[model samples]
Target: MTDVMRCEAVADIATPIGHAGRVSSPVAEFDPKRVRRLRRYTWWSVVPMASFYAILVITGLVNGFADGTYAAADLLVLGLVLLVLTVEATRFCASTMRGLGQGRHHGAEQAAAFIAALLTAGCVLATKPEYGFIWVLLPAILAASIVTNATVSLRWPLTFATCGSTAFVVATASWRYGPPMVPIRFALIAAAVVAFTIFVLVVAVWFWDVVLELDRARSVSAELAIAQERLRFAAELHDVQGHHLQAIALKGELAERLVGADDGAARAQAAEVAELARTALRDTREIVHGYRRSDLATELDNAREILEAAGIATTVSGHARSVAPPLQPLFGALVREGATNVLRHSRALHCEMSILTDEHGSEVVLRNDGVYASDGTSGSGIDGLRERFATLGGQVRAEHRDGWFELVGRAEEPGRSEA
Candidate 1:
């Protein structure tokens, strides 16, 4: 629930109601109750405006009565007109809310709201002969809604234009009525226009900043993933290649010692050396191929060959066929990294490779029983392997205890083995 609340808040802030004329909110934050509340508030906007109209009617009645010209029939008619305008305003707000929440026809709702406000203003102006001061209520309510919403979409533009036109009409009507402060009223209208323009510019800048921030975040995430992949690749190369070279060097020295005493023995040892060299070449090619990162099965085969050439027994078991292609490289990378670690660090007589696949994707494990050095430092190989797996949204763990070492890598989904 807390996560949901946070997501809603982010969505509400990010979604822009720009010049597209659509009332688009962040889909993430949309809830039926929120829509209902918007509708309630929109309709509730009519209350203050209607109250002003009531005051106008009451004042008119009081003025007429003071001059002995007031009639109960005239007051009743004025009250009825106010009631009709209030209902229209309520309907317009309700429709706007429905459009906003349902992702329906927003443009139509905005048009309706504009039209209603304009008609109400025009009505007030037309009736100013009977209730002279009543005309002020329309522009006051328009300005209030504009300030309260803080929104500058199509509706706002329409609002600004409507209010400006209403001001022009009011000013003209006042001049005709010989009002003493007509010029002051025109000056206030000019100020409202300037303020609304400034509001529009501010909203545009805010929207641009939001888009830029989102792009920056995505770029940072991508860079981090690439860095992790590079590390894992380095670790894998160190582990696999390091052990193979060490064994070849050791075998060459042994062959040199037996060469002079017995020709046959010397030749046999030479053959072993030759075989080891061939195996090493094959393993190196496979590792390079892993830089391209082939399927899981291919990597498994290479791992087995590398282990066996190092005189370490290896066993692989489980269904190897159903793994998805996208995940193949990740699995292969895991196998390559694991085998390299075993050869360089484990010194185990036997190593086991097992793969299991079910509904959850796939799992690969490598374990060996060998002499694991207790030195509490990992070489560049292990560090590189860790970084690689992390890029693919996977993890690697190395454990050593009782002369056994285990390296495990698992990925949520397969990715390219090469960084």
Candidate 2:
């Protein structure tokens, strides 16, 4: 349960909200995407780990064969231990590829591997005194594998196992060979082997984490990109609909007021309202056709019109056409979002916009002092705009202060990092 929860938490951090639930589950059925991701992860993580364990098994067997000190029974015993280790090592690899103890237990499996390690170490100790060091190498490698593959925390147990195995190997070497010389030489050997094994295992774990984190980061980037596209589309849609809807509402009301005064004037006003509606429909189609990403110059004009209709005093300065070509989309979205926010949220009748460009880059500041209900920050639109400008080393900030709300965004000049 803890492992499951832990994996889920990591997935949540790495995956996007829309796909978090489906992708986070280790127990999830294999789809093409999941399989592809897992395969890539395993290629780098599990394959190298398996190679490390294989080396131990092969080296241990070679040591046993080359040293002709064992009887037939002893040889059989060594072979039996080697067999157990080989199976367990292979099992470790399989389990890793499948998922870290998805349907099985982690601690128990690590314990079992630890015991196999101890058994291998013991066999090496009993066989040949001259080859006592080989025993430490095989078991230490196995210990490293156990440490790397564990799902649950095994820091304390792994510490005990390493310490115990090192001690036992040293003691066995002392008892087999001479006194001071044997113990001193073997203790140093055991300590070296144990330290190297722990280092390999720890580094393996660290590299594994890096791989997972990279994978998670990739997924998040892809999802965030999709989200930004959707938001830009929605914000554009809102701007289209809002601009026309406000026009229709204002013109229809005007026609209503003028109907009793003059038939000709009322008819003309109604005709203009009809023309605006048709223009809105055409604009919506053009927007859908991807005719333009953002039109800052046009949006600024529409903003002033909309705000004035809403009885809000508006002061707009700075020419959008003067902004660098690359920055049109960013400032375009900004103006559209700024207009929507001012007309919808502010209860006061004052707004000020200033678009400035200089050495640093382009900047847009939209401020309004009114009955500030919310922070007046752009929702998904902000994220989309931020992403666009960030490519050019830009940033965005929103502030509500002193009975006033402010949104300030700036993008740096490309290739001017030295400045």
lDDT of 1 by residue, 12-128 (tens): 222111111222231221122332344354445433444554466567657865665546775566557556655543333233322222213345544454455445444544554
Candidate 1: worst-modelled 10 consecutive residues by lDDT: 11-20
Positional deviation of 54 in candidate 1, in angstroms? Answer: 4.5
What's the lDDT of the predicted structure labeled candidate 1?
Answer: 0.53
Per-residue alpha-carbon lDDT of candidate 2 for residues 164-194, written as tens digits (9 for 90 to 100): 6676656764665677776667766776776
Per-residue lDDT of 108 in model 2: 71
Residue 380 lDDT in candidate 1: 73
- The deviation in Å at residue 248 for candidate 2 is 0.6
RMSD of each: 20.2, 17.9
Go through the candidates in order and give each one's C-alpha lDDT.
0.53, 0.60
